[model samples]
Target chain A: MATDRPLTAKGLATRARIVAAAADLVFHRGAAQVALADVQAAADVSGSQLYHYFTDRDDLLRAVAVHRAAELVANQGPVDTLPALRAWVEANIALIAADNAAGGCRLGSLVPQLAETDPQTRATLSTAFHDWIAHLAAGLTTMTATGVLPPTADPHRLATLLVAALEGGILLAQAQRDITPMRTALEAALDHIASLATSP
Target chain B: MATDRPLTAKGLATRARIVAAAADLVFHRGAAQVALADVQAAADVSGSQLYHYFTDRDDLLRAVAVHRAAELVANQGPVDTLPALRAWVEANIALIAADNAAGGCRLGSLVPQLAETDPQTRATLSTAFHDWIAHLAAGLTTMTATGVLPPTADPHRLATLLVAALEGGILLAQAQRDITPMRTALEAALDHIASLATSP
Candidate 1:
């Protein structure tokens, strides 16, 4: 668990810096390879300050996971229609392409490493994904309510599938060092959702 | 590079045992967390024996990745038609459920960790995925040749999408600790392929 003590504004700023630094390192370098000293150097915080913010490396990792989830959610904003969902996916693909398809999805990259070994961390990630799916589902629900999608469309299920396909596409793209795989996979997913449209 | 020396029958057995044990450890414990001592203890091999087989942990990890790819390919057997493809996907879902959705795809789990950090290992995993994708594409190609799929269907693209969705679905299911996400994602992929049928 993270520290429960109250923090001043400066302390909060310092904590956020540490988490951002840790998130970058963990995303590029695997969690097992990152050390507290690395985080300290990256964040330019003293040893005592690092310990003050996080109880241990695991605690810091939890913070990084949360930070990443928040960043992803924030970047995605809201999705209230199929075009919004498609644009959200395109943004993800564009991000990967911008990075040369080198690193995959931040959450996707971390979950496989930590999900089985750390139950608490896994739960945090799972909740992040659940919330993410819920956000997408909410958009789909609106589309259905507005009569854009067929009444038979299950927003929850479709949203889950969209997220799943996106993660998988990112993985394949990273592995192949190309964006086409990701693009094709996501295109198929969006097409599937469009097929659920009432006019289709 | 691995050792260039030829191994006797007994030597081959020892090397295979070390890789198998390492694969098991890396599957349950993240690659970074599994130590040399853990590999030695799990394989019941002496320190020198471990070093003699693998120059370092990275080498061992590469071997494990290859071993995992072989195992996955062997498990999938063949995919020559839409039904065969569906069965292949069903088998993957069943394997995850059998493990209680504890550990996701071995390749999916490892690719994110090592793909960015190690180029050689990334290449190994990339080739494995490429080969796996080719196998699926072969099935789709056969379907097209047999008039089951329309000429408009690009086997390579569809195969890539299928793999991407499977990996993504497995990641979501593993994170959520449920099989529904994986099942749904795969069902969508298979359905997409089915929609490419000549009549459809």
Candidate 2:
């Protein structure tokens, strides 16, 4: 919870429910368009339950941002080697395909739909993306240490490209209702990274 | 116009004005939340003036997609050469910097913001992207033809990555209020393409 108040396990579950419902509503529809009443109905929570978890709309959105950030970051697996990165990419593609490419990037779908977001919420979302980028960067750094890639390869830059391929590819997938764009984008970025491999 | 009826020059100007305003509105605020009335006010046109140009909202969005597509395509300078593509990237970067990184990609900005778009309208937007993708692919193909790149270079795939970088990079730029993500993404893709060039 964004609130510092201690929560029981049941209380934590309820808060998670509200945030999940709020995230879904905000993703399909713009944040400015989804009302508290809609979130309450979707979560099957009383107004008291909603109010107990969040103080206001900004607070709720911030919580959603935080929750989503953690989820997105946690979703990434190993990326310290070319094979591992390929596996990671394929796993993500499978997830999207399983959803029939309906769900865009879990966090990215919410970014553009937000209107008049507070600076704090915006920062939270930005930090979430950066945190994900840092994780990928860390893997690339490990690859360098393991002699999988040349030290000349900039992990930060490569990671940035990989993440963009993901965010942008998902957008393309949503538009075309096909996974080719996403797959191609990810492969291109991965190829670029693999191109930096130290000849074994 | 998506409508078959041809318009006079002044009519075309009015229609273009309406689209630019509507695109701006849709880019910042989601399409579902933006009303026809709001577009009318933003464009400073009477309701008749608005309806005279568009039969309804879907027609208007289709027009906006068309208008934005043409504009984005025209914005790309010659990309048949590596240097030309680099220059193109820098020009785009300067444009974003000039705006203080406020505006996102010209076409991609409206994509996720639209909710429940009509099929025809969605197809129009998709084709618009494909057109840009084709343009970039054509450039890479030229490289293969001119022997700038080897025959093994896959133009379509490379081009997809390039456009993804642009769209995804811009999304990152919007989130971070910095141009480095977009720059890094474009460079990484460009480097991949450049790496395909045969040794001179």
DockQ, every prediction? 0.75, 0.55
Model 1 residue B72 CA deviation in Å = 2.4
In model 1, how large is the Cα lDDT of residue B40? 93
**Chain B, model 1, TM-score against the native?**
0.94
Looking at the true structure's interface, with contacts defined as alpha carbon pairs within 8 Å between chains A and B, what fraction does model 1 recover? 0.74
Candidate 2 lDDT, B57-97, residue by residue in tens: 87888877777778886786789988998898888778777
Q: Write the per-residue lDDT of candidate 1 for residues B86-175, one digit (tens) a residue.
A: 789988888888876777888878888788778888888888888988888998899999998988888888887788888888898888
lDDT of 1 by residue, A1-200 (tens): 35677998998999999999998888777787799999999999998999899899988988888888888778766677777887888888888898767768888788887787778888888888889889889999999998989788888878877888789888887888988888988887888788778863
Q: What C-alpha lDDT values do all the predictions have?
A: 0.84, 0.80
For candidate 2, what is the lDDT?
0.80
lDDT of 1: 0.84
Best by DockQ: 1
